[model samples]
Target: MTPRPGVREYVRLIALGRPPVGWRTTDVTTWSLARLAGRLIDRLVVPRMSRGTLRRILREGKVS
Candidate 1:
């Protein structure tokens, strides 16, 4: 099982000079660290992501 690339990972990729894949500029612009943390909690509780997706993100260090 892997985890999906969450908001923080997406943001990190962008910060690393990578282009946006499935995310919008507003999505990154509007997110604060606090909001990202909250969303992480939500994902943990709600289980919206599959483990494979997250594993890919971890292994690749970017969203594909």
Candidate 2:
């Protein structure tokens, strides 16, 4: 089955940081600093995320 997103999936959007131009995800109604933080915490419990890693992923992230 497709791993669909729920209230929990918004966190991946955090992994997204500032939304990578053409990037998109599921289960979203708005954008707010507080909301982003909440979603990141609500869904995927990313223990530690670094700016450098985020930057690298932005550079090397796979595309279809």
Candidate 3:
């Protein structure tokens, strides 16, 4: 999207969004290393993103 001029303009910027979910089956306090920016970007339905590009987006958005 390259909407970094002010990414917060593209979508409602949730600087820190929800975290990943985990299911230990025996515990619910376990979380993975999922540093996935916590909703830095919305998971679009029309197109999917590649890790590399997402990284670039993060770099451009200065959210990295």
Candidate 4:
């Protein structure tokens, strides 16, 4: 099975999707890192991400 990207990776890519360059990071503290992780799983990295094993990949601390 393949792996998924992390929160920092997600944020980095999504941020990279934007222009001007300086608006890369965010301060969204309302959401836990896990929730951000889940969002990165479900939204950005799913379907093309292989299987439905985001939680396992995350717990394993490995990202493709």
Clash count for each candidate, listed in order shown: 6, 0, 0, 0
Residue-level lDDT tens digits of model 4 in 1-64 = 4543464355445433333222233644243344444555657564343223444444454432
- Give the top-scoring candidate (lDDT): 1
lDDT of each: 0.44, 0.41, 0.39, 0.43
Q: lDDT tens digits, residues 1-64, model 3?
A: 4344454333223323334454222333422223333334345421343455556655555754
User: Distance from true position, residue 34, model 3, in Å?
Assistant: 7.8
Residue-wise lDDT of candidate 1 within 1-64, one digit each (tens)? 3333475465345334532344433435444334433444554633454444434444466433
Better of 1 and 2 by TM-score: 2
Residue-wise C-alpha lDDT for candidate 2, range 2-62, written one tens digit per residue: 1224422434445455533432435454444444444444446544434444344333433
**TM-score, per-candidate, Cα-based:** 0.29, 0.31, 0.38, 0.28
Task: List the candidate 2 regions with Cα displacement exceeding 4 Å.
Answer: 1-42, 62-64
Model 2 lDDT, residue 16, Cα? 53
Question: Which candidate number has the best TM-score?
Answer: 3
RMSD for all candidates, in order, please. 9.1, 10.5, 6.3, 8.3
Error of 3 at 63 (Å): 0.7
**37: Cα error in model 3, Å:** 9.9
